[model samples]
Target: MNEHYDPGQRRLPSQDFLSEPARSIPIRYRPDVLVVGGGPAGIAAATAAARSGASVLICERNGYLGGALTMVTLGSICGLYAVSPEHITPVVRGIGAEIAERLHTYGGTSGPMRWLETASLPYDPNSFKLVADDLTAESGVELAFHCSAVAVTREDARVTGVIFEGVDGRWACMASSIIDCTGDGTVAALAGAGFEHDVPNGQAPTTMFRFGGVDVERARQISRPELHACLERAVASGLSLPRTAGGAFSNQPHSMHLNITRILRDGVPPNTLDTRELSAAEVEGRRQLRAYLQAFREFVPGYEGCFIADIGASIGVRESRRVMGDYRLTLDDVLHEGRFEDAIACSAWPVEEHGAGRGTRWVFLAPGTYYQIPLRTMLPEGIEGLLVAGRCASASHDAHASMRVAGVCFAMGEAAGVVAAQAASSGTSVRNVDFASVRADLLRRGAFLGEDRLTQPV
Candidate 1:
């Protein structure tokens, strides 16, 4: 049989042939760091890593960055700083605080400290996305949007690359070291690192929704009514609160972000999230959020014209997995104000717990005290070439509440970025990093030190 090729049939139009030129341009995006997630932590990590002269790449799933802050409109950043005699202090310096200061300049964040969250600030989500983009770009970090890291590649228990799902289907890029900033330890899970989801009884998870047309000033002047009280009034008015209906308020004039559901999932399953379960949680969570908003208008003060502005397209999960790091930070570590030469961030936000079918709890530190989060907590146990940041970092379920805040997450991410870059350049394992050098770098980047520095200036 003779096989003949038709030249006419094989010929392509210029439109098609243009891209397939004889000498095709090589599509190469080699980054020194591959930071996963686009939230505060991921941004900090990518920025720090790239700023250190390492080619860096940030992969984010959504078109917009800022993670929970942009998605859920989180109220305040926890663990940015702390003040106390045994203060433990915030050792995290560098790009993390720089971003915070910059955000403040843009009106999304308030100017620095003031007794924990006294100066809690808010900004338009779209604006934040721009700020994040400029930040990573300015640091010379390449960014990939609409990208999700679904898998991690390892060799002999060492991380080498992140397997991603993006516009180009499945592909991966090599990295000397990786930072697991995915809040749920998605990368760590793929890396075979150990973790524990909300312990004992599953903890409550929330799908954040926004309420617009709110009288923010009026609401701020006095207690417009906390979520619990608002629900209580609803009950009095014959409305019942969903078992999962609970959340902290956000900064939108009329918007309140709710953490109103406990998504039930098999922790042992290959996936931590399921569309069906997540949808159910969102539906139920929104129902409760609307009910409370109605109650606020009818029974509470300063909620007139307030209505559900938007519900998070994506669920804002609080806990799923905690990477088992070399040091397991415990509740006692927080209560004792533990400090370490490898300190990464500081916190004063108390042990907060949101029970799924039960209720909510906030355990605060003494009036002026704070705690230190050691660096060992970020090192995944038995996993070389991997660093965990954000909520997944090493911490007891309860300790996570304090460290999981956005401000703290940023510092942690930055630390991880620095560590990863250092490891890549020096040809050393993450464990071999010099803390003094890290500290020096952080300070140079303008990170506020000492717990009192976190205090609100009168």
Candidate 2:
């Protein structure tokens, strides 16, 4: 009945099983604010909180920073500028603008380009990662990689600390405030926060791929309609094409980034948190990429001799868990350009909803206008010491469609970080902080919260 049984043993009695008594995990570090998920929102939150005189710690599961921007190889950073045919207005400022400025300084970004009606700033993913690392380090934020938040430690209504699993082992880190920026709202969900799921079908998840040896100049010569027409012809010729009107952009000489493949997770919901299904989706995405390579080589003119230079480190998941916060942003708010008294961020990106298969629909607001994202959307209802940012913020599906872009995420994160720092330093709950003071600090930092004075001239 020894517990040290043979490894090749077929069976062992339950009483003979080895077990360890529950013990307290070693505390690795204690910070005023602990930001989980090192994507755009987490980076912004950690940097801003640290700059606000709070000791901050940011944990990321990825080896590098820049969340979706770098991991998914998302081609562009959208939602920074207001959408209008007459002129473009940059509304997302503060840390978002700073990141873009850094990218521009490195010649890593392309000027504003209109896509699906809204304007987006495309940048080199490598440049974004470099800038994110520099800013996070410079802000005096402690960084840990290959670490994932697994569970929440709470006292009554407030989250006291977070338990994470990493290569070293399970450990706990205490913090006065926690920011959930895992895109999928991992931290908030673990803290018993209510959330929504897409159920039958979520917004289509795409696996971005890039092509090398492409004739970028020649590809630019063809109109989008003409290119889609070519794709239609390819589909008619028995090419297994998932989407026909998907587009690609030239990022470098002879290099093009394409966001075309659509992986339908039919049986498995996008937000199920099932590792097996996620792995299957990734495999299917790669398979689809190969099929696209064949079609590109045969049908497209510029891609005749091109080859896939890279594929995304992970698939681009559009919708996941939308945490139920104090305020749920609705479509009417976006379409009518609704303003809020406690507005923390502004977005002008239209509601770009992608369905399961081929088509995507767009709905725009009035010209030279945008809607405000209230601070309540980031404050999960009934959850203290927790703030939700990025795609997981409280919003209706349609409203999320517009505000889930990178630039908007940056704004939200900055606001959440400042709020967290204020609450942590004051030893008060996030709900008890004075929002007017937060606004004043944001304005000083160049964040455009739909304020006329802060809005940059086009």
Predicted candidate 2 versus true structure: per-residue lDDT over 1-458, tens digit per residue: 11111222334566777776877899998999999998889999999999999999999999889998999998788889986677788998999989988998888887778765678888889898899989999999999899899888999989999999988999989999999999988888788888886645557788998999998888888777777888888899998878877767776899989988877765333433556667888888899898889888889888899998989899888888889999999999999978899999999888987776565677887777899999999999899999999999999888999999999999999999999999999989888899999999999998998865434555
lDDT of 2 at 402: 90
TM-score of each: 0.83, 0.93
- In angstroms, give how far residue 273 of model 2 lies from its true place: 1.7
Error of 1 at 120 (Å): 3.4
Candidate 1 lDDT by residue in tens digits, 1-458: 11121122334565654332433222235566677888888989988898889888888888877898787655555555444543334434466556656776677754333432222334456567778888888889887888787666678978888877788776776777778787878788778888876333445566666667766666555442364565576777786554323434555445654444444434211122545555676666666666666776775566678777777766667776878899988888777777676777666666767654436666767645667777898898888888888888988777886678787788888878888888888888787888788777766776543453453432
For all candidates in order, the CA lDDT equals 0.68, 0.86
> What's the lDDT for residue 406 in model 1?
80
Best by lDDT: 2
